[model samples]
Each structure stands twice: as C-alpha cells, then as structure tokens.
Target: MLSRNQWLAVVLIGLLVVSQLPGPMVHSVSSRPAHLLSTLLTPLSQWMLSAGNRATRRPDLLQRREPGEDAVRQLRAAREEIRRLQRRIEEYERIRHRFGEQLEAFDYVHAAVTRWSGDPANPWLEINRGRRHGVAEGDVVVNYRDLVGRVVDVGPGTATVRLITHPQSRLEVRVQPDTADEPARHHLVMVDAVPRRGRFEAMVEVDADAPIEQGDIAFLHVGEHRAGRGWPEHAYGFDVGMVTRIEPDQERLPLLRKRIVIEPFRDLPRLSNVTVFVRREYERPDDN
Candidate 1:
C-alpha cells in the first residue's frame, strides 16, 4: 500500500543500520556459538565413534585369529603323518632284507627255528622246517654266528636241532696260529665232552717251547664235509674260550704237550635258531 518513494526510503534505512554494526560483533555472533557447541560435544562424539568401531572390529579380528589357529593345527597334523609314514617305510625295509636271506636258503630246502628245547638234560630246538623241508639227520646246523649242532630227527612239520652245548655233541676243530712265529697246527680238539666246570673251556696241546699265551683267539674250522654244499672253507670266526689255565707236560708223546683251557663263546646258551649246511663232497688234505 505504501508509495514507491516510501519503499525506497525504508530499504535505505535498513542498509544503513546493517552497515553501522561492528565487524567484531558480527564475527562473534556468527562463530562463537558454533565453536562453543562443538567443544562441549567433542568428548561424547569421540566416545560414540570408538564404541561403534570396537563393536564391528572385534568380530573381524576374532575371525582372522581363528583361521591362523586352524592353520597351525593343520600343519602339526601333517608333520606327524609324515613321521609315521617314514617309520613304516623303514620297518618294511628291514622285513624285506630278512626275507631275502631266508629265500637264499630255501633253494636247498630249509626251515626257520621256532623254539628251543627247554630240557637241560638234552638241549635241542624245534624248527619250522623238517623232513618235508629236506632237513635230515646229520645235517649240521649253524646260526648266523657259529655252528649250533646237527639235526638228529625230523617230523612232519618240525625238526629237532641238537645244540653244540649238548652233552653228546662233539666238534673236531683245528688250531690256527694267531702269530707269525707260531705254525698252523692240525689236531683233533674235542668239544661238549669236558666237565661243566670246563664246559665253556677248550684244551690244546702245543710244543713245550711254543709261545702260546692266555687270551689267544682260537678259530673253529668246519670240515668241508660238515659244512653245507658250496659252503665256504671257513664258515665263521669265534673267539675260542679265553685261556684260563695252562699246564706244561714234558713227558707226553713225540712232542712236549701243553694243555690250554679255554672258555666257549657266549652264543652257545642262546642258540634258538641255526642254519643247516649240507656237505656235498669231501676234499683231500692237499686240496685244503
């Protein structure tokens, strides 16, 4: 309703009033309240943000840790499995080696021992191989170490092995010189016939002047006939019993004789298994 001139005058008055206001007063009015409000709310705002992040991040961290733990457990299991497989492989190899050795003896028909005779009066062993396995009487039995005895009887599936330590068992052995000065002497030495006190002993007669001493090694020579067919001239080496005592006899036969006592090898008492060597042919003294 006002005239145009009156409207223009009113606008000019409003502008003058705005222009007269202080610059500091204007700035304070606009910025002070906003800054104060922000300062008052800062702690609460930060707390809320932290709580939200924890709520979300906790589950994520837990999930990641779970995977790590699972990986560690799986790795341990794999290592254990590998170790078990290696042990099994080694065991198989041992069994295979033993089988191969047995097969070599099988070409000639032989059996493995199961148990030894428990009787002290007649020490013997029961073998899985018998007459059916070509085991026969007088077939000399030997272990991996030394001569065990000979097969005296055979049954359908079993055979009895007379141990070398038996009362009636006897082995003819030759004495070999261990030193350069000593000559190889051939004599028939007896075993298993000496008294129990001497059961583990060996007696040898040497020249009175022979430099024979105690603790010398006595080698047992298996006659080619006693050893199995194709068996080597000397099947085994054993420490003849230790020389415990020595007796010098000057009045004995053509040569002065010295009696040397020896202890038998420890393999005697633990004889459970032995190999039977079948002698194929006899060799003359010159052939040896």
Candidate 2:
C-alpha cells in the first residue's frame, strides 16, 4: 500500500507505456480477436442463408403443382367436347341425306317408328309422322334397303303402318321366271297371303303353260296392271322377295294356282324407321 503520490505516479507510467507502443503492433493485435470471431460465425451465417432460400422457393413449387393439376382437368374436358361434336355431325349428315332424297322428286317422308304391334303374325308399326306431316292412308313406307309397309291409320302427329308380311297385306308382284325370254313380258303374280308356318308360304296364280319355278325373284309393282299384252306401264319397282318353293294345285283348272314360299325384301322385324312415298299418279285399266 503506497502513498497517494506513489499510486498516481504508477498510473501515469502505465498510460505512457501504452501510448508509446508502435501503430502496426496495436493494429495486428486488435485484428486478431475480430478474425477469430468472424471464423466462428461463418457456418451459422451460411446455414441461415440456405434456410431462407428454401423457404422462398417453396411457394413457387406449390404454384407449379397447381398448374399441372389444372392442365390434366382441362385435357379431360376437351376429350368429352370432341365426342359430343362428332355425334352432332353424324346426325346432321343423316338429315342432309333425307333432304336430298326428298328434293329429287322421290316424294319421301321420314318417320321414326314409335311403337310396334305385339303380335308377330299381324305386325304393324306406329310412326312419328301422321296427317299433320302429309302422311295419309295408302302412303307407301320404305327405307334405304327396300319397301316396308303402307300407312293404314293416321292421327295428328302419328300414324300406323301395316307391314308387308301382315295377313291382310297383298303385294301384286311380277314373277320374272328364271328362264324367261324377256323380263319385260313377265306377267303379274298375285302374292295373296302369308302362311302361318312351313317356310313362310304365299299364294300365286299362273297359266299352266307359264314358266314358273322355285328360286325366282318376285318384284313388287306399285301401280301396274297385270293382264296386259305389252310391257308394264305406269309401274314402279319397290321390293324384291325370294321364292323358296312353288307347289301347283291340280284342283285349280286351266290357270294353275300355286302356293309359293316368299321372304320379304326388308326384314320387318328389325325396322326402326322408314320413308313414306306418296303416289302422284293414277293408273287406268287400259294404261298398259
């Protein structure tokens, strides 16, 4: 424990020693502590920078996934729209064809079958077109393949057609013999009625000398007279039925009455729709 004057002298000597030190030595010593602190904090600073970069990019990744999901949904919707457009195109094509047929003086009317008679023997079809659509009794109904039937009854917007195979229906046909000399000279054969069974038979009358045979093609004539001497006049070819067999009846005199098995041109059982053709001309007895 020195006196007050001795302590003051020691403090002054310590200050003078520090003030006389070289500037380079002081700077080097001072920088050493800062360098040590910087090395220690380097890894923590780098870790914080890496974590912030990941946090910033997370929102962009989520946005990318959302766009990918939306693209998938849009692709599916586009496929369905293409299918709907294709169906509409098909319907338009069908209507266009129907219009062309009507404009060509074919006298055609398109009608969809709404109902069918339950009885297989006496078959009939109810059509969507009726008197309101120019559909009347005796209007011939046909399809792209062949004739179907004739309208029998009419309502405001609906009509019923008697099928070709119905018992009451009789199609006057010209039997073109397989060995005929000329197709124009072939006379008329009455397709009387449809048999209940046994190969779907029908009736026809022919002169005993007339060339008639099985497997002949029977063609239906709409407005033709059969008893003429020359070629058929005022006739329209509508149907083709195959003759399965022909059996002559001996009891019938000079004219041979034969039972002929016939099949229809169009399968009436599968008919869905048909076109009705209105006959524009009338036939006289002496037309042929």
Candidate 3:
C-alpha cells in the first residue's frame, strides 16, 4: 500500500539507527601501549600520595629534631641561674662599697664571734681575730651599721669585747626628736646600762618636760669624751639606737627627772660577724 520512494526512505533511516546502537561504549587510543600507561601512572600516584603524607608530618619532624633539645633547655636554665648569681654579687658589692665609705679614717678587720658572755647586763663577746690581724685591745667592734663594743683583750688569734650593754659601759649620747612638728633640737645625755627583769636597758636622765619621745634617735656625741684618758675615740654622728620608753626616775628624783630608756641598734645575742676599727695612734704631749 506504500509508495516505492517512501519505503526506501524508511529503510535508510533504520540502517542509520542500527549503525549507531551496535558499537562499543569506550574508545581506545592507538598512539601508546595501554599496559605501559597503567604501569607509569601507578608509580606517579604512589609518589603523590607519599609527598602528601610527608607534608602533613613536617611539623612533628621539626619538633623531634636532633638530641640537642635537652641541652637547649638546660642551657637556658643555667643562663638564668648565672644572671641571678650576678645580681646577688652586685648587691654584695654595693654593700661592701657602703662599708668602705663608712670606715674612711680607720681600716677594718673582719671577725666572727667565738662565744657570748651569757650575761645581758654585763654582756661581752669573744672573737676569733686578734692582735695579729691588727685588732688591738681598744679597737672598736662594729656590725654593719654602728658600734657594738670595744675589744678588751687580745691573744694571738682571739680577742674579747665589752659590749655597750655592760653595766660598766658609759657613753655620751644625744637624743633627737624625729617628728617634723617638733623643733630641730638635740639634748646631751649620759647613758649607762642596767639589768631590768630579763633584759639589759640603757638609761639616761633628761628634763622632765623634754620633747624626747618614742621613735627618737640617739647618736654618740664623740667630742665630749675626747679629753678623757680611758675613753675610746669615736667619730661624730655614730648612731647608737632609739629611745624606746620614758620612765620616771625612781632612784634619783622622780618628780624632777625623766629617765630615757634606749634600745641599742646592735643585737648583742645575734652578733656572729663584726668588723674591728683601729684608731690612729698619736704621740701624747707628755711623752713628747
């Protein structure tokens, strides 16, 4: 029932469709060997994977470097210790310089206390340095600050000291008021030690209405004792201690006198190290 030309067109279209549907889904390249391509590409992929792994592990490797890690830590610690020691040395040098400045006219001999007299009222000390080290019988013994005592006896390598707390000790001292509200005034007082209860106290008499109060400082008025035969030479402005309390003079005149109790700056019982100050010798007028 169809025309010859229409039937021929339909048959041609079916042939085109059948040609497209029958071929393989993949294309093969003919320029290279297929087996060789897989072999070469496999190694390249392995190399890329290994490179990625190494990149991720770089931070950990950097931390784990050679065995010098412990050494570096120890080196830093040692440097810090050295700096600390240097600071301590510098402090010690500063103290030494200050001591040198304080002891200008007299040379110093360092010593350690060998024993204490066990008597606060008549306190004395025995030291390990003696006449061989220029520590004479009358040399002044001092702590870092001020006078502690005077050397009484000297052996070849040992010496004895009579402290300011001794009952026989006598010193000319000046009392000063530290408060700014008070007038700038200092009063001369003769001080001596006495045993009270369990401790030794230096007592001095001042005016009943003197402005001397607690916290007032006391200094040795050295020029007053220069004319005496048995007195030790001392520089002016040597600090003795502070006035701790003011009591009524019970033995002398309680109504007319006020007793000043001074606490010495030097701690007698704790004295382990001291420096001896040697006074310069001068020929007496009688000797000349």
The global C-alpha lDDT for each of the candidates, from Candidate 1 onward, is: 0.50, 0.57, 0.63
- Model 1, CA-based lDDT: 0.50
The order by descending TM-score is 3, 2, 1
Worst 10 residues of 1 by lDDT: 57-66
Instruction: Encode model 1's per-residue lDDT on 1-288: one tens digit a residue.
Output: 999999999999977986788976665464445434434544454355445434542232113223354777767655644553464344335444544453344333344555544455566665666555566656656654345566776654556677655666454554443333334433434433343532334555666666556534354543444553222333333223434566875457535678776545443434333566643323212323
> Distance (Å) between predicted and true CA of 284, model 1?
22
Two-way lDDT contest, 1 vs 2, winner: 2
Q: Write the per-residue lDDT of candidate 2 for residues 230-264, one digit (tens) a residue.
A: 21222235444656666666566635555566665
| Clashes by residue pair, model 2 | none
Measured against the true structure, the TM-scores of the candidates, in listed sequence, are 0.43, 0.49, 0.57
Off by over 4 Å in 3: 1-105, 179-183, 197-199, 279-288
Report the lDDT of model 1 for residue 202.
50
Candidate number with the higher TM-score (2 or 3): 3
Candidate 1 residue runs with Cα over 4 Å from true position: 1-112, 118-121, 177-192, 195-200, 204-206, 219-257, 278-288
